[model samples]
Target: IYKHSGELVAKHAFRVASGLDSMVLGETQILGQLKSAVRTAELAGTLGPKLRQLFDASFSVAKFVRTETDVGAHSVSLAAASVKVGERIFGSLSNVNVLFVGAGEMNRICAEYFVSYGIQNISCSNRTLSRAKDLAETLSGDYFPLSDVAHKLEKFDIVLSCTGSPIPVLGKRAIEKAIEARRHKPILLIDLAVPRDIELEASELEDVFLYTVDDLGEIVNDGMRNREGAAREAEKIIVERLVQFKSQLDRKKRIPVIKKFRKRGELIVQIELEKALSSIAKGERPEEVVKVLSRAISNKFMDEPSRALNNDSTGEKLSLSEALERLYGLNKN
Candidate 1:
């Protein structure tokens, strides 16, 4: 429902790709996510010419944002944030039994963060049991099928989920049952899925603290004061790049107009040359024929402008006259 000029729309995309407008200031995850989105659109054949150009330029801007600035110095990621939440809630993670759902890149990253804290109990649950086994083996933890997650939910103190499921895997009632079975022990659940692996209503349950992708970013941004200067510097780079891209876009927009104008001039030249050739063939003087050709071409060029000035019904005709005078130097005499 929103309408914006191409330049303004591109400006927003450029800022977002640079992580300047991210919920988590200078977070690196969004760039990967944007790349994935573009790839998906490409596969689906929905990536139009302008959109493809926008994303391609955006990726370049993101690269400059990272290399040209110190914004990447403070890498407070959602995985780290999830670990922070566990530490805050449990006071100690060495004994906290962790359950990771969907062994994707996000889960692997979060598992590594938890491992860094010296937590030993980590389990992986995924639809592909083999994938779960691979991640669990890497993390030196146990593995289970995702189908068993709901039944075994009460066994873990913390659960981190990121899946490509079309529907919510953990419903509100299931969470309530798990909380009841755990005897009111609090559970920290983080869902980093696009369609949400956990139910939205599950967040309302007691003894359950649920944080989504956006929630993690908002929480992480609160502690990102160190990156503010780097963010400003990155913005300067984006502005410079945007101006260059805008100039390119402006030139592209003028192509059709320039082509049409040239076409009209060529047509006028062709008509006059044909008449001049016919007059010469009928034994007219070559110099007189050339003179007629030049005058006819001049008049043809001026015909539209002369009619526009004479009609002058619009109040803005003065501006049109000014433009004509400026373009042709009609006042030179």
Candidate 2:
């Protein structure tokens, strides 16, 4: 593990929270994950006050970056890319019938992306019709059984398939026949599964435009490249916010020392004032009493600090003496 002290620690966390260090560069989901981890630690009684402040500062920096710059603009996720490719082929998706195969997480996300893009007609199919129906209801669409996909394929203008099946759920012949039934009106097929829910051979058929996960990844990468400028802008914002946060952190660290120093000075003032009053009551000259009081107060305040300086090792003493001089603005004088 790497160790960073003072401001560097906050710099690292702020950059990561803002997605500057992410693989997709400006990807923003990681910030949410960090917040979730923070909540877990809070629930377990592990996060201290200082650590909580650091995370809170990082979150503030992330939100500021999002507002001031386009760091999270042009999202490069696969779900968004699927919609991009659909628009490329069909001009617009408002009139298209979308078939979402496999009501799994990936398919559900893609279905949501399509619906959010204003695609009115969509259907869901799964091995278990209940899951598909649930997803369909969530999207306000219709549901069909996986077994019926082959015969019903022609009804959809776009087919998005992602499943955990070890074998292909869609074959070349199935797509080919669907094209014939559609009178070759052109169909867009997006396969986002690892084992490939749609057969690779389906790409060879006419009027069947197929895109795999790798293809969408390339589109996402193109988006990542386009966001480089925004990422740099966010980096600049981090540097500015880091400096401001560091100053605030330093002041917070000094608060206890400031309180103790003020308390000790007050005690010295009270003790010396009593001594001065006694001398005046004993018939000492006013000048003599005032002179003695001032000298006593100064010596008493300096006594502990003088001893501390004398007790330190040579190097520590020199550094501490210089710091004290600067703190008192003695060097400036």
Candidate 3:
């Protein structure tokens, strides 16, 4: 599905989850992720006009929710749950030395949340040291080569791993050595990777706490229910925004008509100006000639738009006029 209509479907999914088409509205993380996903798809050349429109509307709805409702004002996102889990294991994140494996998007987000919790001694290790360094700069942390994980594992009180490796990066024996080096000081490990970064056996060892992405699901579900009422209000805001977006999109379809009108008006102006210039060159008074040319051009320009406005039987012209009025800030009192 992802290969064929993945981009479009993902974009629509974001719209729905963001409350643009949701039962509950203004869920911030989903919308932001949706936008990110859309951008990624666009850059990959997988996004088409249909998907783009849906994603754009979704973004509009998400923005409306942020501005018009309290849905995102007090929301708890998955990132927050990850931080909570870290806090639960360590008690206070203030003094914990943290190392993040992988400089991917999820790792960056988790690092930001950890920094928010007052973790200062943070570092990142990735296969590409440059990528790790780039992410480290954002969090004001240090970077190390991925191979150094074994040597430096004991230094950090917490390890958050999420990389694109097929095999486990941290095995049971390696963690066991790190735990022994720390003299049994507890190490909290949060693995956000899909195929799993830390070996499952590491969780069974004493003084090493491991929480995978699945473990955080419960916390997120609990947090989601707490804001159910706010979500409904957000959904209402999204629906209104979606309707407004559709109206704007429909108005955009009339661009060719507006373009044709402008083109014809310019052509008429050019022909009349040429005539007026020819009359002046043939000994007509310069001031009088200029005045006549100005009036002629003005009349010619206004003629089509005025005619369309007056001879409007169907409401298409009225709708177009209203759209233009709103666009140009022209008020008819």
Candidate 4:
């Protein structure tokens, strides 16, 4: 129902899928999101040949940008930013005890970043114990139920929560108790959830360093500015890709025309060949049959153009003869 022109829509979709329009510039998540959308459209049979071509070209462009540019050379993902913030607070992530409060995609990505620093003391707690256990095992960490999160909170120095909880999962009172149990040691609490897994009041606690999704946007913006040069290079690549996509679409559109033309020519050849063979079978002269075949073929090929030229009723300045002469590059002499 959106009424953008095809060129504009293609450009916008390509930019978004390529991460040029992302909050975290050059982040890989948007590519996956775009792929998922395309797959869904394909499954629903709504992705026709043209759309398939466009999206395929888009994927190629995204891959080209990622491989050819340094756009994603920093911590652009919010999950990755959490690890950076943790390192900033503790100097090194390897020595810190990290507790991921969810086993979803974001938490998994965050855990991977932390584990890359060789952080051995990692834990995951989720409503579904199996999913949490799977995530913990992948990171070589421990898993606990959501109910045990409050009691176990004091054990970890850095806690990152990304969940779909409607209400705040960790309240100020709960975090304050954890800080007390930890002898007032500072805890980095990253709330990646939309509704906020950690209560807003927890930010007021002196020992609880709380950061929400909005806070992460500042880091993501800094990354975007840093990659501006790479983004410019990516835009150049997109221009090239756009040219290629349009050329391909034009060529595809001409396929039926090309086929029809070729079929008509082949049919004319068959008719001429049949007439020449019939004359030979009737004992007509071989040289005469050859002359008749060539003449018949030429006439058949030019019949439509001759008829169109003769039927020109309008007294245009550029007559049909002049048009045909120009079209065929005929010498006036």
How high is each candidate's TM-score? 0.56, 0.64, 0.49, 0.61
What does the lDDT read for residue 240 in candidate 3? Answer: 65
Stretches > 4 Å off in candidate 2 = 1-9, 82-109, 112-122, 126-141, 145-219, 281-288, 302-321, 331-333
Model 4 lDDT per residue over 75-119, tens place: 666877787788778886667898999889989988897787688
Top of the candidates by TM-score: 2
lDDT of 2: 0.90
Q: Per-residue lDDT for 1-333 in model 1, tens only?
A: 556686878888888888888776887768989999999999999999989988999999999889988786664778777877887788888898999999899899889878876989999999999999999999999999999999999999999999989998899988899999999999999999998999988888888999899999876675476688788888889889999989888898999999999999999999999999999999999999999999999999999988998888676688889989998898998
Q: Which stretches of candidate 3 lie over 4 Å from their true place?
A: 1-75, 229-333
Residue 305 displacement (Å), model 2:
5.1
- Tens-place lDDT per residue, model 3, 1-333, is 233353445435534556544443344446656678888999999999977877676666666656765555442655777767767777887888999999999899878977876789999999999999999999999999999998889999889899999999999999999999999999988888989999999999999999888887777666666566666776566556656666776788888889997898788888988988899889999899889988998887767767887788768887868867996688956
What ordering of candidates by TM-score runs from best to worst?
A: 2, 4, 1, 3
TM-score of 1: 0.56
lDDT of every model, 2 decimals: 0.89, 0.90, 0.79, 0.87
Model 4 segments more than 4 A misplaced: 77-121, 124-222, 310-333
Q: List pairs with backbone clashes in candidate 2.
A: none
In candidate 4, where is summed lDDT lowest over 10 consecutive residues?
309-318
Off-target runs (Cα >4 Å) in candidate 1 are 1-6, 77-135, 138-223, 329-333
The predicted structure with the larger TM-score, 1 or 4, is 4
**Candidate 2, TM-score vs. the true structure?**
0.64
